[model samples]
Target: MTQNKAAPQNSVETYTIYATSNKYNRPPPPSTVALHGMDLIGAPIDIRNHRFFHPPPSHLMSTTTDLIDKLKSSLAEALELYPPVAGIVEVNEKGEFYIAMNAENRLGTPFLVEIKDTPYVGDSETLSPRLDMLLPPSSSALAVKLTQFSCGT
Candidate 1:
Protein backbone atom coordinates (compact mmCIF):
# COMPACT_ATOMS: atom_id res chain seq x y z
CA MET A 1 0.00 0.00 0.00
CA THR A 2 1.18 3.49 -0.71
CA GLN A 3 2.30 5.53 2.27
CA ASN A 4 0.13 8.52 1.33
CA LYS A 5 -1.90 9.66 -1.66
CA ALA A 6 -1.64 13.12 -3.16
CA ALA A 7 -4.49 15.55 -3.87
CA PRO A 8 -4.74 17.36 -7.17
CA GLN A 9 -2.59 20.48 -7.25
CA ASN A 10 -5.14 22.67 -9.06
CA SER A 11 -8.27 21.00 -7.68
CA VAL A 12 -10.49 23.21 -5.45
CA GLU A 13 -13.09 21.53 -3.24
CA THR A 14 -16.26 23.04 -1.74
CA TYR A 15 -18.91 22.13 0.86
CA THR A 16 -22.53 23.26 1.15
CA ILE A 17 -23.93 23.72 4.66
CA TYR A 18 -27.65 24.29 4.84
CA ALA A 19 -28.86 26.58 7.61
CA THR A 20 -31.76 25.62 9.84
CA SER A 21 -35.21 26.56 8.57
CA ASN A 22 -35.81 29.18 11.24
CA LYS A 23 -32.44 30.69 10.40
CA TYR A 24 -33.59 31.62 6.89
CA ASN A 25 -33.35 28.02 5.78
CA ARG A 26 -29.62 28.45 5.59
CA PRO A 27 -27.23 25.96 7.14
CA PRO A 28 -24.08 27.82 8.15
CA PRO A 29 -22.26 30.59 6.34
CA PRO A 30 -18.77 31.99 6.32
CA SER A 31 -19.74 34.40 9.11
CA THR A 32 -21.17 31.77 11.44
CA VAL A 33 -18.16 30.88 13.60
CA ALA A 34 -18.28 27.51 15.31
CA LEU A 35 -16.14 24.85 16.97
CA HIS A 36 -16.06 21.17 15.97
CA GLY A 37 -18.43 21.20 12.96
CA MET A 38 -21.09 23.73 13.90
CA ASP A 39 -19.90 26.80 12.08
CA LEU A 40 -21.76 27.65 8.84
CA ILE A 41 -20.54 31.17 8.39
CA GLY A 42 -18.65 30.32 5.27
CA ALA A 43 -17.43 26.87 4.24
CA PRO A 44 -16.70 24.44 7.07
CA ILE A 45 -13.06 24.89 7.93
CA ASP A 46 -12.94 21.29 9.04
CA ILE A 47 -13.64 20.14 5.47
CA ARG A 48 -10.92 22.40 4.17
CA ASN A 49 -7.94 21.99 6.51
CA HIS A 50 -7.92 18.29 7.38
CA ARG A 51 -10.83 16.18 6.17
CA PHE A 52 -9.88 13.35 8.50
CA PHE A 53 -7.04 12.23 10.77
CA HIS A 54 -4.98 9.05 10.74
CA PRO A 55 -6.27 6.22 12.88
CA PRO A 56 -4.84 5.75 16.35
CA PRO A 57 -1.26 4.49 16.73
CA SER A 58 0.80 7.21 15.17
CA HIS A 59 3.30 6.93 12.22
CA LEU A 60 1.22 8.05 9.25
CA MET A 61 1.62 11.80 9.32
CA SER A 62 3.36 11.38 6.00
CA THR A 63 0.18 9.87 4.59
CA THR A 64 -1.77 13.02 5.29
CA THR A 65 0.97 15.04 3.61
CA ASP A 66 0.64 12.82 0.57
CA LEU A 67 -3.08 13.54 0.48
CA ILE A 68 -2.27 17.19 -0.01
CA ASP A 69 -0.11 16.38 -2.98
CA LYS A 70 -2.76 14.23 -4.63
CA LEU A 71 -5.42 16.88 -4.05
CA LYS A 72 -3.33 19.43 -5.93
CA SER A 73 -3.02 17.13 -8.90
CA SER A 74 -6.76 16.46 -8.91
CA LEU A 75 -7.54 20.17 -9.13
CA ALA A 76 -5.53 20.85 -12.23
CA GLU A 77 -8.13 19.04 -14.37
CA ALA A 78 -11.26 19.42 -12.20
CA LEU A 79 -12.67 22.34 -14.16
CA GLU A 80 -12.72 20.40 -17.41
CA LEU A 81 -12.76 16.76 -16.35
CA TYR A 82 -14.87 16.67 -13.19
CA PRO A 83 -18.04 18.20 -11.87
CA PRO A 84 -17.78 21.86 -11.03
CA VAL A 85 -19.37 21.27 -7.62
CA ALA A 86 -18.20 17.91 -6.35
CA GLY A 87 -17.62 16.60 -2.78
CA ILE A 88 -14.22 15.26 -1.72
CA VAL A 89 -14.73 13.02 1.28
CA GLU A 90 -17.28 11.47 3.64
CA VAL A 91 -17.55 12.17 7.40
CA ASN A 92 -19.52 11.13 10.52
CA GLU A 93 -22.59 12.78 9.09
CA LYS A 94 -24.40 10.95 6.31
CA GLY A 95 -24.16 13.88 3.91
CA GLU A 96 -21.03 15.50 5.27
CA PHE A 97 -18.16 15.44 2.76
CA TYR A 98 -15.85 17.61 0.70
CA ILE A 99 -17.29 19.62 -2.26
CA ALA A 100 -15.18 20.55 -5.28
CA MET A 101 -15.73 24.06 -6.62
CA ASN A 102 -14.80 24.93 -10.16
CA ALA A 103 -16.21 27.66 -12.42
CA GLU A 104 -19.77 26.62 -11.58
CA ASN A 105 -20.30 27.66 -7.92
CA ARG A 106 -22.87 30.42 -7.88
CA LEU A 107 -24.03 33.00 -5.32
CA GLY A 108 -27.44 33.94 -3.77
CA THR A 109 -28.64 30.41 -4.37
CA PRO A 110 -28.86 27.21 -2.38
CA PHE A 111 -25.82 25.15 -3.36
CA LEU A 112 -26.13 21.45 -2.65
CA VAL A 113 -23.38 18.81 -3.15
CA GLU A 114 -22.76 15.07 -2.90
CA ILE A 115 -19.60 14.31 -0.87
CA LYS A 116 -17.52 11.16 -1.19
CA ASP A 117 -14.44 9.69 0.49
CA THR A 118 -11.20 9.81 -1.43
CA PRO A 119 -8.50 7.13 -1.34
CA TYR A 120 -6.31 9.48 0.66
CA VAL A 121 -8.88 10.07 3.43
CA GLY A 122 -9.60 6.36 3.41
CA ASP A 123 -5.94 5.29 3.54
CA SER A 124 -4.90 7.51 6.46
CA GLU A 125 -7.84 8.92 8.45
CA THR A 126 -10.38 7.31 10.78
CA LEU A 127 -12.55 4.44 9.58
CA SER A 128 -15.68 6.59 9.76
CA PRO A 129 -14.46 8.34 6.60
CA ARG A 130 -14.62 12.03 5.61
CA LEU A 131 -14.13 14.29 2.58
CA ASP A 132 -12.18 17.52 1.78
CA MET A 133 -14.01 19.76 -0.72
CA LEU A 134 -12.68 22.47 -3.02
CA LEU A 135 -14.71 25.66 -3.40
CA PRO A 136 -15.32 28.03 -6.28
CA PRO A 137 -15.37 31.82 -6.27
CA SER A 138 -17.99 33.29 -3.95
CA SER A 139 -19.64 36.65 -3.75
CA SER A 140 -17.49 37.23 -0.73
CA ALA A 141 -14.42 35.14 -0.09
CA LEU A 142 -15.21 35.61 3.60
CA ALA A 143 -18.50 33.91 2.81
CA VAL A 144 -16.50 30.81 2.04
CA LYS A 145 -13.67 30.53 4.54
CA LEU A 146 -12.07 27.11 4.91
CA THR A 147 -10.79 25.73 8.25
CA GLN A 148 -9.47 22.29 7.21
CA PHE A 149 -10.82 19.33 9.21
CA SER A 150 -9.41 17.75 12.42
CA CYS A 151 -9.80 14.19 13.68
CA GLY A 152 -8.30 11.51 15.96
CA THR A 153 -7.59 8.18 14.34
Candidate 2:
Protein backbone atom coordinates (compact mmCIF):
# COMPACT_ATOMS: atom_id res chain seq x y z
CA MET A 1 0.00 0.00 0.00
CA THR A 2 1.21 3.50 -0.84
CA GLN A 3 1.85 5.81 2.06
CA ASN A 4 -0.03 9.10 2.34
CA LYS A 5 1.89 12.31 3.01
CA ALA A 6 -0.87 13.56 5.29
CA ALA A 7 -1.44 11.18 8.17
CA PRO A 8 -4.69 11.56 10.11
CA GLN A 9 -5.13 12.94 13.62
CA ASN A 10 -7.28 9.92 14.41
CA SER A 11 -10.02 7.98 12.67
CA VAL A 12 -13.50 7.65 14.06
CA GLU A 13 -15.87 5.23 12.34
CA THR A 14 -19.11 7.12 11.87
CA TYR A 15 -21.35 5.09 9.56
CA THR A 16 -21.86 1.54 8.30
CA ILE A 17 -24.30 -0.20 5.99
CA TYR A 18 -25.04 -3.41 4.07
CA ALA A 19 -25.27 -3.09 0.30
CA THR A 20 -26.12 -5.72 -2.32
CA SER A 21 -26.01 -5.76 -6.06
CA ASN A 22 -28.94 -4.04 -7.75
CA LYS A 23 -30.10 -7.32 -9.27
CA TYR A 24 -29.76 -10.10 -6.74
CA ASN A 25 -32.64 -12.20 -8.03
CA ARG A 26 -30.88 -13.16 -11.23
CA PRO A 27 -28.92 -16.36 -10.84
CA PRO A 28 -26.05 -17.74 -12.78
CA PRO A 29 -26.19 -20.93 -14.85
CA PRO A 30 -26.63 -24.13 -12.89
CA SER A 31 -23.17 -25.31 -13.85
CA THR A 32 -21.59 -21.98 -12.95
CA VAL A 33 -19.39 -22.13 -9.90
CA ALA A 34 -18.17 -18.68 -8.97
CA LEU A 35 -14.92 -20.01 -7.57
CA HIS A 36 -13.64 -23.53 -7.40
CA GLY A 37 -11.75 -24.60 -4.30
CA MET A 38 -8.66 -22.45 -4.07
CA ASP A 39 -5.23 -23.83 -4.73
CA LEU A 40 -2.21 -23.23 -2.52
CA ILE A 41 -0.90 -20.29 -4.54
CA GLY A 42 -4.31 -18.69 -5.15
CA ALA A 43 -5.45 -18.90 -1.55
CA PRO A 44 -2.22 -17.41 -0.25
CA ILE A 45 -2.30 -14.54 -2.71
CA ASP A 46 -5.97 -13.78 -2.10
CA ILE A 47 -5.52 -13.67 1.66
CA ARG A 48 -2.64 -11.20 1.38
CA ASN A 49 -4.42 -8.52 -0.61
CA HIS A 50 -7.32 -6.15 0.00
CA ARG A 51 -8.86 -3.97 -2.71
CA PHE A 52 -9.88 -0.37 -2.13
CA PHE A 53 -10.76 2.44 -4.52
CA HIS A 54 -9.90 6.14 -4.23
CA PRO A 55 -10.86 8.06 -7.32
CA PRO A 56 -8.92 11.11 -8.50
CA PRO A 57 -10.00 14.52 -7.31
CA SER A 58 -11.19 15.38 -10.79
CA HIS A 59 -13.65 12.52 -10.66
CA LEU A 60 -15.03 13.50 -7.28
CA MET A 61 -18.53 14.98 -7.09
CA SER A 62 -19.28 18.47 -5.83
CA THR A 63 -19.70 17.50 -2.18
CA THR A 64 -18.91 14.64 0.13
CA THR A 65 -22.55 13.66 0.32
CA ASP A 66 -22.78 13.59 -3.45
CA LEU A 67 -19.64 11.53 -3.72
CA ILE A 68 -20.91 9.05 -1.16
CA ASP A 69 -24.29 8.80 -2.84
CA LYS A 70 -22.75 8.12 -6.20
CA LEU A 71 -20.39 5.62 -4.72
CA LYS A 72 -23.22 3.62 -3.15
CA SER A 73 -25.23 3.60 -6.35
CA SER A 74 -22.31 2.72 -8.55
CA LEU A 75 -21.30 -0.06 -6.18
CA ALA A 76 -24.67 -1.74 -6.50
CA GLU A 77 -24.44 -1.62 -10.29
CA ALA A 78 -20.88 -2.89 -10.29
CA LEU A 79 -21.77 -5.79 -8.05
CA GLU A 80 -24.54 -6.71 -10.47
CA LEU A 81 -21.97 -7.11 -13.21
CA TYR A 82 -19.58 -9.03 -10.98
CA PRO A 83 -21.98 -11.21 -9.07
CA PRO A 84 -19.38 -13.66 -7.88
CA VAL A 85 -18.10 -11.12 -5.33
CA ALA A 86 -21.55 -11.10 -3.78
CA GLY A 87 -21.33 -14.85 -3.17
CA ILE A 88 -19.98 -16.44 -0.06
CA VAL A 89 -17.06 -18.82 0.37
CA GLU A 90 -18.23 -22.11 1.79
CA VAL A 91 -17.04 -25.69 2.07
CA ASN A 92 -18.68 -28.56 0.24
CA GLU A 93 -19.50 -32.00 1.67
CA LYS A 94 -16.01 -33.09 0.65
CA GLY A 95 -14.52 -30.21 2.62
CA GLU A 96 -13.45 -27.59 0.09
CA PHE A 97 -13.93 -23.86 -0.21
CA TYR A 98 -15.83 -22.42 -3.15
CA ILE A 99 -17.78 -19.30 -4.00
CA ALA A 100 -21.38 -20.48 -4.06
CA MET A 101 -23.30 -18.38 -6.57
CA ASN A 102 -27.05 -18.13 -6.51
CA ALA A 103 -27.44 -20.54 -3.60
CA GLU A 104 -29.25 -17.73 -1.82
CA ASN A 105 -31.79 -15.26 -3.18
CA ARG A 106 -30.10 -12.28 -1.53
CA LEU A 107 -26.50 -11.21 -1.96
CA GLY A 108 -24.23 -11.33 1.07
CA THR A 109 -25.25 -8.74 3.63
CA PRO A 110 -23.43 -5.87 5.45
CA PHE A 111 -21.12 -4.39 2.84
CA LEU A 112 -19.51 -2.41 5.70
CA VAL A 113 -19.45 1.25 4.75
CA GLU A 114 -17.69 3.51 7.25
CA ILE A 115 -17.25 7.27 7.47
CA LYS A 116 -14.29 8.62 9.38
CA ASP A 117 -13.58 12.07 10.73
CA THR A 118 -10.01 13.21 11.15
CA PRO A 119 -9.15 16.31 13.08
CA TYR A 120 -7.02 19.05 11.61
CA VAL A 121 -3.69 19.84 13.10
CA GLY A 122 -1.58 22.93 12.51
CA ASP A 123 1.58 20.85 12.14
CA SER A 124 2.22 17.41 10.66
CA GLU A 125 3.62 16.27 14.03
CA THR A 126 0.09 16.09 15.44
CA LEU A 127 -1.07 13.54 12.87
CA SER A 128 -1.48 10.02 14.11
CA PRO A 129 -0.70 6.76 12.36
CA ARG A 130 -4.11 5.30 13.01
CA LEU A 131 -5.60 5.47 9.53
CA ASP A 132 -5.72 1.70 9.36
CA MET A 133 -8.24 1.57 12.18
CA LEU A 134 -11.06 3.12 10.13
CA LEU A 135 -12.72 -0.13 9.10
CA PRO A 136 -13.09 -3.47 10.74
CA PRO A 137 -13.56 -6.72 8.86
CA SER A 138 -17.05 -7.79 7.88
CA SER A 139 -18.62 -11.16 7.08
CA SER A 140 -20.13 -9.77 3.90
CA ALA A 141 -18.68 -10.77 0.56
CA LEU A 142 -18.07 -7.10 -0.17
CA ALA A 143 -17.18 -4.09 1.99
CA VAL A 144 -16.62 -0.34 1.57
CA LYS A 145 -15.27 2.30 3.93
CA LEU A 146 -15.03 6.02 3.28
CA THR A 147 -12.42 8.13 5.07
CA GLN A 148 -12.81 11.87 5.15
CA PHE A 149 -9.86 14.12 5.84
CA SER A 150 -10.13 17.17 8.04
CA CYS A 151 -9.30 19.46 5.15
CA GLY A 152 -11.73 17.60 2.91
CA THR A 153 -8.94 16.77 0.55
Query: Alpha-carbon error at 59 in model 2, in Å?
Result: 11
User: How badly does each model clash, as a count of residue pairs?
Assistant: 55, 0
lDDT of 1 at 43: 54
lDDT of 1: 0.32
- Please give the distance, in angstroms, between residue 10's alpha carbon in candidate 1 and its true position after superposition: 25
TM per candidate: 0.21, 0.53
Q: How much does candidate 2 score in TM-score?
A: 0.53
Tens-digit lDDT track of model 2 for 1-153: 977775545544433332353466665534234344334233221221333344447555666668777766776666666755655555567765565555463344333333435543333422332234332322345445455555553
* lDDT of candidate 1 at residue 30, scale 0 to 100: 30
Model 1 C-alpha RMSD to native:
16.6
Compare the candidates by TM-score and give the number of the best one. 2
Whole-model Cα lDDT per candidate?
0.32, 0.48
